[model samples]
Target: MEIPAPRRTRIQQEKRELILEAALEVFSTNGFRGSTIDQIAEAAGMSKPNLLYYFRRKEDIHETLMQRLLDTWLAPLRELDDIGDPLTELRSYIRRKLE
Candidate 1:
């Protein structure tokens, strides 16, 4: 029989975050073409099987990370409001990004 899978979305999200954080650190030093699942798993402090349980493949993780990165990368621009003072809004946007 197959083992039951984890149920909590929170748990899965946490583990996914761990994996992404680790992958980012590893990928920063070694480009995607040079990185591997083993490196990401070791950095994430989880076994290879455990990492795979959350992310099926390195490409999946990379794609997820890239999507999240793009979302955040555009957040400040998304916040721009024509109704707000240009300088003030720009300052607020820069502040948000710095934090």
Candidate 2:
């Protein structure tokens, strides 16, 4: 049987978000290969061990960020209609993405 994930308290959830944001900033400037857990933890204003308590590895942080980005980035495209005029649909899709 599969075990369920534990529920996080509000603070824990917030800390996780903080780590993800910090990771995103570091990865954006340094690229994933150049970024490190120390950098992300420092950016998040937390210690490396503390950050590790939330995400065990830099790869975990990157994967979470990419997954969130993909969900958000692809949502607008998924909304595009096959029935609408091609030009209008494209314009609407672009507008949704820009917004």
Q: Any runs in candidate 2 off by more than 4 Å, and if so which?
A: none
Per-model clash counts, in order, read 0, 0
Cα RMSD, model 2: 1.8
Write down the lDDT of every candidate, Cα atoms only: 0.94, 0.95
Error of 2 at 90 (Å): 2.2
Clashing pairs in 1: none
Query: In candidate 1, what are the lDDT values of residues 21-89, reduced to their tens digit?
Result: 999999888999899999999999999999999999999999998999999988888988989998999
Question: What TM-score would every model get versus the actual structure?
Answer: 0.72, 0.83
Could you tell me which residue pairs clash in candidate 2? none
How high a TM-score does candidate 1 get?
A: 0.72
Write one digit per residue (lDDT tens) for candidate 2, span 13-63. Answer: 999999999999999999999999999999999999999999999999999
